[model samples]
Target chain A: MEKTILHLDMNSFFASVEQAANPNLLGKPIAVGGGIKKGSVVAACSIEAKAFGVKNAMSTWKARKLCPHLIVVIGDMTKYIYISKIITKMMVDYTDLVEVFSIDEAFMDITKTQDRFGGAIELAKDIKRRIKERFKLTCSIGIGPNKLIAKLAGELQKPDGLVVLREKDLPTKIKDVQVKELCGVGRKTEEYLRLLGVRTIGNLNSYPREKLVKSFGMAYGEQLWQMGQCHGASEVRPYFYETQAKSIGHSYTLPKLTSNTEEINGYLLRLSEQVGRRLRRENYKGNVVCASIGTGDDKTSSHQKKIKDFINDGYQIFKVAKSLLAITNKIRFVSVSVSGLLHQLDQISLFSHVENQKKVLAAVDKVNDRFGEFTIERAAIMSTGLQGKTGMVPPKLYGLRNFKMELRGIEPLTSRMQI
Target chain B: MVKVGTIIKVGVVFQGSKIIPRWFIWESRKYEVRSLDFTWEESQGLEKIIRFSVRDGINSYELAYNTIQMNWALENIC
Candidate 1:
């Protein structure tokens, strides 16, 4: 069976949103972040700002030095989230099997239904047109057989570009392009591959899988080899019920290192709430909680607690991290991370001591999910102020038993999807 | 260790003033307490400035942060 997948990405998301909302910012060198004194940096930069050599994540002070004319805007995450939900709605119109890959990216498995629609290329064109007409924003669309290929296609072009890649065109189109440009390829991986003279996708295609796996992890080695062949999976399963986290931790960088235990605890409470909210949203609860701190000198120390059971909720997670921080003096950075997750279980283990807390958290999750997130955030987090708002970051790992077999039927995994 | 006077820029997609030295930044908000990858030259005035970025009205505080701390005579540790 042939699969057609479509990936959509908003261009320069935050800055673009600012431009969309305010026409004046369109041609200007605009940055989205905190005011100068806020110690924030530019999260996104407009094309005009790019022209000035300004870039994302550059300090506002440095950005100002780089472009004195640059206009800065404090990020409005609420607005972006609103737009993201709307975009998700639009994606579902094309295929129910859509995976919200990131806040600004998604993959829609259109393979099984491509013949019913026009074709991969046509669908990509239509989706682009619809997005432009509806959102007044530009997006890059990539059409391919698997998520990896589809993601590659999306980046092949940018800012209202559409790219289509098929097996037949891989050999010719895959050459000349640097392998580092591939989705999963990063600085470390690229350097390692380059040492072996694997500079392009074509080069990787000829590399041995066993050797690659020995060097890279089993996952990356296999994924890269598959992507090299342009034969990755086409299965666009409904977004995974188990969301994998890139980093599962909460952190706060103090204005400077402080001995004030209250200030440190304040940050911990805020982070715990944020992490707990995310765990419950995805039906995951964690068993490992880690604490880390950074002194203003850029050095860090960390510790982890392996709990007998999993729990999710800001107050509890905060208690653990705070307990650890209580012993550390004059810390500059603080973080709380929970890992080793299990699906939300209905049956409470008879031996557990925190059942009452779990019950309270469940109610809170229901109310917040229904009304709006943060409708009932931890009171301790309130002092972090408006800027300390949290998000549904990636969720922690859940065990095999956590996955429901019923969801597998929605989309079958394929050869192309595996990589 | 990132020290005062460190001209450290976390994850910079590009240098603000020009394309020659600009690059993308990846450091996160949680990093505000410490200076991440920086050079000796970067630390020259690192003690005198606080830094952050704004994008499309959003802030990447952790990824992009710099600030100068008041100069306190260094206590040479063994």
Candidate 2:
């Protein structure tokens, strides 16, 4: 049976949310994320800012150069996460098979539920309307037979666009579009495809599969061939689906380039604690700890060490990370990550001190969870001047479990009668 | 923007699932909510705090209501 899928992409999500929250910011060019010092990159920008050629990931300085009056706002993750949860709940009213693609994008499989709303178009319009009515925000939604085509259709329109592209209409609708427009084709892949004279989706569809596989390798090349034919998986994993995290990491760039070991170690300790807290919260322990350092001259060196025992304690992770840091040059950035994960289970330590340490950490975790992140911190962190005002941390991705708003009791709105 | 974690009294109306903040008293002065621009919720452990971004005739303020404590606080101003 043919499946019906809808991809919904929020229009300039961060910027839009900021505008909705502040009446004065409405109808103005704005970007989210320059931190408190206004020295970082633009995480996202409004359509008004985009009109001035300001784009996401551009430096705030450059963005200012392009749009002199562009307002750069510090992001509030808690607010964004809360709104995202409410939006997800609204989507769940339509179908349980909803896959959150990102903080601002989602894919819903309404194959079984579309008929109840009369048809796919009606269902998509209803979702779009509900979102705009409740949040004063707009989204572009695409309706198609599979996720890829649905996403492509969504991309065809912007800021409250609704487009439908059936599998039968794929060839006519997208064949002339650039191969780079496909989801999986990145900059390097696009350049390689261009070298092969495959500029359009039509060219890729007719290109030799043998040549593709030989050039790109068997699995990915075969995948590209299928994408060229507009064939994609129809599966939409719901929020309840269990998924494992591969790694957990955090990195920070210093305000000024420094060779000071103590300051660098302070940053490392803070990052390690962040990683450890997340790992513990998720009941994960890892055997590998990796550390990286970036220098003033644009050089980065990284090292990883596999430990004998799995660990999730922040101090333990920090010890291993500190040992791995070589610090040959004056560095401005540092990162710490742990992988080789396993589900942590309750275990008794042979040493009494180790057991006591676990208890202490648990107590600390409880305090932080109750009050706020880093409510109880190490004295060393305070001395580093990084204690106050935590940066925005994006929610962990494991289905919709991280939303944490369901327990607050949100009553889903009843579906509108078919029109 | 200024961070003011000071606690203040707020008058609100609960209509179904919506929370409408009508007025708030801060620094011993009562300010009426000219507009309620945005609202959201955050969870800190077992407690859920409902936050509102509202504006008076002159200034904007952020107010948070702790569900467990049944109290309101002015969080920020701009």
Look at candidate 2 and tell me the lDDT of residue A329: 73
Give the per-residue lDDT of model 1 (tens digit) for A220-284.
88888877777676666565354455335556666556777666777777778777776776567
Per prediction, the TM-score for chain B is 0.20, 0.94
- At residue A327, give the lDDT of candidate 1: 41
lDDT of 2 by residue, B1-78 (tens): 688998898898989989999998888999999999888988776688998989997877889999999999999885
Query: What are the C-alpha RMSDs, in order, of all predicted structures?
Result: 15.6, 3.3
If candidate 1 were superposed on the true structure by all CA atoms, what would the RMSD be? 15.6
Assign candidate 1 its CAPRI class.
incorrect
For each candidate, what's the DockQ? 0.01, 0.64
Model 2: per-residue Cα lDDT over A1-419, one tens digit each = 88899999999999999898886788899989855353477889999999999999887888989999998888887788778877888888888788877778889999998998988999888988898888899999998889988988898888799999987888888989898878899999999999999999999999999999999999999999999988888899776566787888888877678888888888898888888887888898999999999987768899999999888988899999999997767888899999999976657989999889888989999988777777788777777777743652343222233443241254323333343
Using lDDT, give the best candidate's number: 2
